[model samples]
Target: MTVTEISRLALYGYQIPLNPPLPVGRQRITSRHGLLLRAITDQGEAVVELAPLSGTDMDGEPIDGFSRESLQQLQDELTTLQPQLGSTAALERAAGQTALPSLAWGLGLLALKLEGQLTSRQPRLAPVPLIYRLPNETADELVQRLATLPRDCRFAKLKIAQNDVEAELRLIYALLAARPDVRLRLDANGGFSLTQAVDFCACLPKGSIDFIEDPCRESADCEALHSALGLGYALDAPLNAPDFELSPLPGLRALVLKPMLIGSPAKVQALIAAAQQLGVRCIISSALESSLGISDLAAFAAQETPDEAPGLDTLAAFEADLLVSSGKALCLELGQLPLLASWEAGC
Candidate 1:
């Protein structure tokens, strides 16, 4: 196995200003925050790794829970791994053995970048289909918002909190009435109890809805609801669970993966393999990460599963372009590395 010596490590915090504060759950985000990692090797090679922050357990927390305060902790952890690097295995050999998820992720990505460089089989970029995002608004308002969607749009996803189930159902019907050709994705974010979830499912026509996600907090509750209703439902946040194993719910639709929070590129690949074996769709979704992380995701998807349209249409939300775009694909733009290294992965 080829081993790389890590001679230096640097971490930087970057924030992109947001025009209007973006809201998730009950909190508002005024800016996007992420960590840019620079790994310099003893071989005089420098690889910039991007780890975007995302998915706050609390509404007000930073993305990925990799906050400003956690910087010191990350520094401390990555410091310990310096010894491992001096005698470390190349990413392919030690991928499954990685202990720290985030560090392993950053390093694995760097390694992938390097491997593509060495082998001359740099990753390729493909146009990813985007789900037109819909707001959790009134029926009339939603129809009005969806009308502005581009003509080629055939897929869409809506954020529904289940506060007013009847009204939300009506909105779904109204959306289909307006654009019946479009398939739908509904995210409830664990809003209902098992009974409530089942009742809500009962209100919908069996063949109308595409997938309803996280209807309740418990896996058993979601499984029971899917079994009872005979409708496809998705497990979104649970995909980040440690040592995540498939739950095999009866009406399982798709597995949503957030690569930043999911941590390791190898682990993400493993999950995709598992999903493929089970005949399940692995949808690579963004947790509102920066284009750096998004580029990471796009590169991974380009190689692993390029056919699926990842839930990653969030470039417009950013104030500036962190990555260069070709056709419809996003890729890294590393100045320190070659102009080629940026496009190498997306080549």
Candidate 2:
């Protein structure tokens, strides 16, 4: 197999339902919104799908940093460059681009290279845990739903915001009462003030909650929140910003990596390596990407040794019909999710 020709590119937009609206910090999400990038070879026999994070909005808007503009620009550039270079060189150049779509493009290009070479190695994809979202209904209903999930799904995450402290806490208590053996994590999404975050974490019983993520507004709050909660803390949105320097947040247990927001895999790997050196755990999570993007992230996660169970379970929030009907399944077993197919035609 040799680098002979480049073919076509296609972008597909998809909307999938969330069983129950997912509440995270100040935002209430009811569906998974994203775009899929497909690269086809000249042979017309190979295809690679890349799903970079398109945020919650499917249409390109607000053209700011980390917006859909980044993806569009990368696609335009790749289309222009593909005709000028061979397969391997194109992939290398695509991988090194400064644009946001570079990671997804690189992953897709690598998959293409593998197909061209007829390599038997399958792209790595680890099982992602499933996360269930609770509706804004009664705590009893939420508990009942939890009881219905498969027994192997013993780890779950819930969203909290500044306004719903009491309700959230009550919900947490109810969940614990229903399944005491489950590990629970709270994602605040920077909804609380420093003082409020301290008070909120302090209200929880020690060891009842596993860890809380991004409760406060500033990176500086990591130490303060850790002290207040008397438990481990993780950073999500804070890590997404490039201006924020990466250092070990005191009392931090895990650092969540969102590749689309961070721009590239090498950069994410660097952060993960730094966190490990500082004795902090690393977790690779998605920003509600399509299966294309999720597949790439899952492959990267499979390469990680001793990584924490990531927030990839957010996939369950959507209806399955929205995805390609013939691809891999997203089922979880013993808290792990299996990888989906990379090509629709079995390339």
Candidate 3:
């Protein structure tokens, strides 16, 4: 069998406007910018997107937060390294030396797609948390939104650190009462200390929450809370930590894997296998990429964690997208997307 190789590389840049401007930390992002990579092989062509968070505004000032690198950084690196990336193995080697996780993730997907690994799979629905938007949204409004959720929606996520614990509790109770069949997933994003996390978890209705993600800054605090209250916890920010390890930590219910933040596909797959061996669930999530990126994520989720519903309820934020229409069930075609730059071995 002839070994397939990347015969050509085509790069395109896109700017998808976000209505209402996405709020990240203290910065507000008006538009999302990134690169689309199309890798052609003897078999066919595969496309992937590398849109980092905190993309620059019209003033060229980075929004600051979420992602470490900017879209310009990825473009520069890929342009300089385009010649050497002729195969999946070469891309992996290049990614191992790079500091950009988003680039590696995009290359990984492209490699997987070219190798016919990312086969299309049925898309699953993820509950959009009512609390992510509208900081001052009332419990009644939240409950009304909860009632609007699809009948088959089995899980919902909520942001707890944004609001006071008491007010959040009332909203949670309201959501539970309104849709008793749907379970709740709470994420603190490591905004709380040990004491505050404990106090907050103490007030939660027992057996109602699916898990609390990054409840505390310290892993020891998470373990302590789990031991004290037996509330399940999920690891999110810790996955990005330099010392991250997949252990069956006390109260570790799941691992929230964001491909954009995580390294390459191989590295992510290794983590998934190791995590599964420890009997922990892995939930593939998104960092608010356009429909193109989300389509790849859905394919990845179906290929890797078929049973778990991914946290991909983020496409609703984009004002518009390129090629594919906006939504979860989307598949990107290389011919459909516009191109900006191209390179080939013989060209």
Best by lDDT: 3
Off by over 4 Å in 2: 1-25, 29-33, 40-85, 101-136, 243-245, 305-307, 320-347
2 versus 3: better lDDT goes to: 3
lDDT of each: 0.61, 0.58, 0.77
Question: Per-residue lDDT tens digits of candidate 1, residues 79-176?
Answer: 55444443234444344464545555676776766444323222342323333233454558758666667666656777676347787778778877
Which candidate gets the maximum TM-score versus the true structure? 3
Q: State in Å the error of residue 70, model 3.
A: 2.1
For model 2, residues 62-120, the per-residue Cα lDDT tens digits are 22223343445655554555443345445545555645544444543454444554233
Better of 1 and 3 by TM-score: 3
Better structure of 2 and 3 per TM-score: 3
What value does the lDDT take at residue 95 in candidate 3? 67
lDDT of 3 by residue, 1-347 (tens): 12368889989887767765665533457777778887888778877889877556545676543678777788888888888888877776776667788888887777677777787774555523434554466678868888788888888888777657788888889889999988889988777899998888999886888999888878679999998899999988678653577877878999999888877887789889999999999999887778878778888998888889988876666776555675434434556556778998334
- Runs in model 1 deviating more than 4 A are 1-8, 23-27, 40-71, 86-100, 117-141, 323-347
- In order of TM-score, best first, we have 3, 1, 2
Which lDDT value does model 3 have at 224?
94
